[model samples]
Target: VKEICSYMGVSSDTVYRWVETHEMPVHRMGRLFKFKISEIDAWVKAGGANRKPQKGNSQ
Candidate 1:
């Protein structure tokens, strides 16, 4: 859990809140939170916000 939090750059509390608030899907294994890497990656992709163009990419 801590590792995933670090990878996502979010606190554990935030992750819990996200789960509680239905921000993302969560998997449970015998009362333990088990998040799959693929799910998280998919969630991040699905939750992507519009990005602005950078000057460097404008060329």
Candidate 2:
């Protein structure tokens, strides 16, 4: 998780929120979350990480 967070340059909370909202690609193994560098790279390339402003966001 830390590695993924570092690679994505985001905090763990953001990652968790993305996973919960089905916005990020990840795998679950029991209580563990798994990720592949290739898949994440592909997702980003496809604009998965291009976050749009939420409806109520102040920013």
Name the lDDT of candidate 2.
0.83
Candidate 2 lDDT score at position 20: 72
1-59: candidate 2 lDDT, tens digit per residue:
88999999999998887777676889999999999999999989988888653554331
- Which candidate number would show the highest lDDT if scored against the true structure? 2
Deviation (Å) of 41 in candidate 1? 0.7
Per-residue alpha-carbon lDDT of candidate 1 for residues 1-59, written as tens digits (9 for 90 to 100): 68779879889987776666555567878878888888888878976212222344321
Residue 11, model 2, lDDT: 100
> Which structure among the candidates has the greatest TM-score?
2
TM-score of each: 0.68, 0.80
Query: Local error of candidate 1 at 5, Å?
Result: 0.4
Pairing residues by index, what is the TM-score of model 2? Answer: 0.80
In model 2, the runs with Cα more than 4 Å from the true position are: 51-59
Question: Residue 6 error for model 1, in Å?
Answer: 1.4
